[model samples]
Target: MRLRGRKGIRETIESQHDLVVLNPAEWKGRWAERFGNEKPIHVELGMGKGKFISEMSVLHPDCNFIGVDMYDELIRRASEKARAAAGREDGSAPDNLALALFNIERIADVFDEGELRRIYLNFSDPWPKKRHARRRLTHAGFVRQYVRLLDSRGEIHFKTDSRPLFEFSLNSFADLNIRLRRISLDLHKDGPAPDNVMTEYESKFYEQQMPIYRLEAVIGQEALAEHEASLALAERQP
Candidate 1:
C-alpha cells in the first residue's frame, strides 16, 4: 500500500537528464554534482514523509541535503518538495534537495565512501526483540555502514524517545569507538539545540510526555557490542 498525505504526489521526480530509481541496486555511488547547491552534503536516513529534511533544507541555504528512505511513496513526496525548491530566488537557500529510495543498510553503496558531511538518525526503529538488536540503525552493523559513508569529521545527530534504543545506541558508540559528543539524555532540560530537526513522530512523542533523548556521535573505531536480543517484530518488508 502506498503511504499517503502530501499535496503534490503526481509530479515527475527526475529531470530530463536523469532517472529516479526505485530499486536499491541502482543507488550505489550515484551522488555527485547533482544538486544546485555545491556546498557540503548533509543527509537524513529514514526520512519519513520528508518533513524534517525538507524543512532543514529550506532553512539552510548553503548546504545540500539528500534524504534516503526505502519507500517509493515517501521519496515521491520528497522529490516534489525538491522540485518546488528549484524555483526559489536565493541560490544558497535550498534551490533543491535530493531523495533516494534505498535501504539504510546499504549506506556505503548509496554514496561513495566518506561522501556525507553529516547524517540524521531521527526516530529509527527500536527493533525491541533481543534477536533484532542487530537491525537497529545504531547497532554495530549499521554503525559500520555509517563509518564508511561519513567523513572523518562528520557526525550523526540522533533523537529518540525510547530508553532501550538510547542506551543501545550509546553502548554501540562506545563499543565501536565512535566518538560521542553533545550528549543529551534529555532534550527539554537543556535549551533545545538551535539546529535540531523535528520529525512527525518526535512531535507525537513530545505531546505524550516522553523525554526526548538526543546525541551526536562522530565516526571512529571501537569493538562491537554483543546484542542481548533480536527484534521480535517482523521487519517491515520493503
Candidate 2:
C-alpha cells in the first residue's frame, strides 16, 4: 500500500526520531505537556495512513490529539503530517497532533486510570474468525485496557463497515455492562444526528457506496466491569 507523495517533511526527521516505538508509556503521562498544553486528551487508535487525526488537530485547536498505530512505515507518514502542520509549511498539516507507535493492548500503561477524555476506533479490523475474536479492538481484552485509560464516563467512538464486527461489538459491550451510549446500526441514515467526521478509510468506503455502522460506549459508575487488565509505554510518537 504505497502512497504517492506522502513524504512531506518526516522524510528529514523520521531518520532522527526512530519512527518505531515499542512502548507508549514513555509518552503516556506527560502527553499533555508534549503539546505545551494541559488541555483535554482524545486519542484515535489505528490511525491508518494519517488523515483524520491530522485534520482533527487542525479543526480543534483546543484539544490535544494522540494518534496510535503499530506500523512504523505508516507512523512515519503520520509524523510527517504532524510536523508539517506544526511548521505551517506549504504541504504541512495543522499542529497539536502527536503520533505514537503503540500496541493498543498497552493503552493503560500509556495513560493512568481516568486520564484520557476519549478514544476513537475507526475502521478497526473485525478479526471475524471465532478463534481470532480476542484480536478485535472492541473485544473484552481491549475494553479492559480502555477502562483504565478512560476518565469517568469517558467515551469510545467507533465506526466500521463490517456488519459482523459491529454486531459482535454491541454484544460485547452489553456483556461488559460499561453502558452503550449511542448505537446507530447505519450511521448515514441516522436522520441528521451528529455530523459524521470522515476518516481516511471512512471516506473511501463512502465513495464506494458502503454504509458504515457506528456507536459510542462509555464507562459507568461500576469500579470494575467484566474484563481483564493491561500490559504496558516509553514515548516517541509514531
Candidate 3:
C-alpha cells in the first residue's frame, strides 16, 4: 500500500537530511559517531508518522533516538512535525533524533551487533496466518535478530491492540528464553503511563476503548546462549 504521492516527499525528506538518513547503511556501526555522542541509541521499528520518537527526543535529550519505517510518505510527514517541534526554519530534526528508511529484515546491515540499547515495536503488523507466524515482528526469528542487534542489557518494548498477537508474542519470548518484565494487559485502563509516548495508531485504538497490551523483554548472556543453542538444535533436527 503506497501513501498518496505527496508532491515532493523525496525533497521534503532530503531537506531534512540532517535528521533523516536516506542511506542508513553508510552509518552502520558508526551511528554514535554520526550523532556525535556516546549516548545510548534507541530505535522505534515501524514508527508511523513519528509522533512517539519526536516527543521522546524532546523529553530525553540525553539519549539518541532513530525512528525506522519503510514508508517515505510517512517519513515526510514525520519530518515536518519534527522540524516544527524543534522550531527549525530548516527541516532539521532535534539534535537527539533521526529517521531512517530501510527494510526491517536488513536491519542488521544498518546497525552492528550490540549497537542498540533498546528497540520499540509499536503496533506492529500482526501476520495472523499460521504459516506467516515467522513474519511476525516478535517471532523467534525476528527476536533472534533483535538479540544480535542489541547490547546484552538491551530491551524490546512492544505494544499492540491485538490480543492474539500479543499472546503469541508472549509465548515467543518465553520460547526464546527472553526475560520479560513490565507486563501490562490494559495500558490505558487507568491512564497513560507517566512516560508513555503514544503512536498514531495507539491514539486511534485508545479512543475505541481497545485494550492495549505491552511488555518489555530482554536478551542477556544466558538468553543469547540459549537462543544460539536452540538454533543449533533446530539444524540438527533433520
TM-score top scorer: 3
List, residue by residue over 111-200, the lDDT tens digit for candidate 1. Answer: 778777788999988999999988899998888777787765567889998889999999988997766666877786544446676787
- Return the lDDT, model 1, position 18: 34
Kindly give the stretch of ten consecutive residues in candidate 2 with the minimal lDDT sum.
226-235
The candidate maximizing lDDT is: 3
TM-score of each: 0.76, 0.79, 0.89
lDDT of 2 by residue, 96-215 (tens): 677777777767778877778789999998887899999999998898888778875477888899999998999888888866645777676634346566887777777776788988
How good is model 2 by TM-score? 0.79
Clash totals for all candidate models: 13, 15, 0
Model 1 misplaced stretches (Cα beyond 4 Å): 1-30, 36-38, 80-94, 190-193, 220-238
Which lDDT tens digits does candidate 3 get at residues 40-159?
Answer: 999999888889888888889999999999989988888777777777676457999899998798888999999998999999999888999887999988899899888865889999
Question: For model 3, where is the 10-residue window of minimal lDDT?
Answer: 218-227
Residue 57's lDDT within candidate 2 is 78
Candidate 3 residue runs with Cα over 4 Å from true position = 88-91, 221-238
Worst 10 residues of 1 by lDDT: 222-231
